[model samples]
Target: MSGLLGNHFITQIGILVNDIEKTSKAYSEFFGVPQPEAFLTDTLDKAQTEYNGEPSVARAKLAFFDMGSLQLELIEPDEHPSTWRNYLNEHGEGPHHIAFVIEGMKEKIELLDRKGFSLQQKGEYEGGRYAYIDTFKDLKVLVELLENDKK
Candidate 1:
């Protein structure tokens, strides 16, 4: 995690879907597991959201499934202009981004910025913050950095 270019372990894989209920059920059936509960992002507190580094009201329906050490995240973008929405609009539903769990978000974001990876979207949850870095052009997928204070 010291440099911008290298092999980084992915902790989560995020997918953009049109319907979270349908997708979660389908994935649950496929994995022979119970369907995960979906959460609305807008309901979170102390949430500061941004799109393309500017303040924005981007919301989404999110669900997570634990798979051993890595987690799979499902995202259904709300009717707003956001990274997820733009991704859905441009490419339809599918894999959207891969994420890494970071400890120091500010330092990591600064490193990415210095490396020319712009912050596409960012938001703060109760005990953590998450950001999406613009990496689709080179990696064919957006990159995410998550910093959880609880962890």
Candidate 2:
């Protein structure tokens, strides 16, 4: 079911937690994955540049743990309205979504639309584009597409 969707690389998995440092430490100490590189909301000038040429304007604590070619971005928002916080506040956390690596995002979105999938939201990240879809909602899950791998 994943082959035609392009290479389903597990580029990232978001684990929305109430505490980032504690979670990072647990992963680093137990699984040997490097504790996430902390990013502050104030230092997202570059992120701002990539996201919208002005940033998404956020304040949160984040860390990344590397596992093979994939990374897990652990986020803890200091405020409300963020999807991560909303997820925990509403649904509790587990595996938020599996990000697939794709090239032509808009086209893929169109394709999904033709396939009867609905878009939840779409955004630009530090190195790629991402969109959340409702295909798996019946199964209580989300399918995410991320454009990365430019080097």
Candidate 3:
């Protein structure tokens, strides 16, 4: 559990929020999740969703933290009718999405894309390159690809 290679089928849940500190504090107070000592950089890109039979890049933001074995990610975007921001603005922000960690990210992205999962955003963080896909219908949820789990 200490090492990334173990993987151990971790379930990563996320909440999208417009304010980082506010959401972090909220989760910490409510769920007893540990607070991060420092902020990490998350470089994001414009993403598109094909759940509606068309594709377009909506607004998005991402942040990360660890909760024991589960990885908690926070995403918030300015809405032009987007999933993250829209959910936060509408539902009031708690457990927005979840991710399953798997190996071979490049092939997974290609395979998921070929299977109709649309790419929303792609970026590189300290851990690895990640691609968020809009699996809006297939999983009835947004799927975030967590890669380079080994540090």
Task: Estimate, for each residue in 11-75, the C-alpha lDDT of model 2 and write its tens digit.
Answer: 77767777777877888889966676677544345443222122345456778777778878777
lDDT of 3 at 3: 30
- In candidate 1, residue 62 scores what lDDT? 95
| lDDT value, residue 101 of candidate 2 | 75
Each candidate: RMSD? 1.9, 4.1, 6.0
The TM-score of predicted model 3 comes to 0.64
lDDT of 3 at 4: 23
Specify the poorest-scoring 10-residue window by lDDT in model 3: 43-52
Off by over 4 Å in 2: 1-4, 41-60
lDDT of each: 0.88, 0.66, 0.63
Q: Who is ahead in TM-score, 1 or 3?
A: 1
Residue 109 CA error for candidate 2 (Å)? Answer: 1.7
**How much does candidate 2 score in TM-score?**
0.72
Error of 1 at 3 (Å): 3.3
**Model 3, span 49-136: residue lDDT tens:** 4323334355455556777778887776655555565667767867666776768877777777887887665555566665667776
* lDDT leader: 1
Best by TM-score: 1
Candidate 3 segments whose C-alpha is farther than 4 A from its true place? 1-8, 37-65, 78-92, 149-151
lDDT of 2 at 115: 83
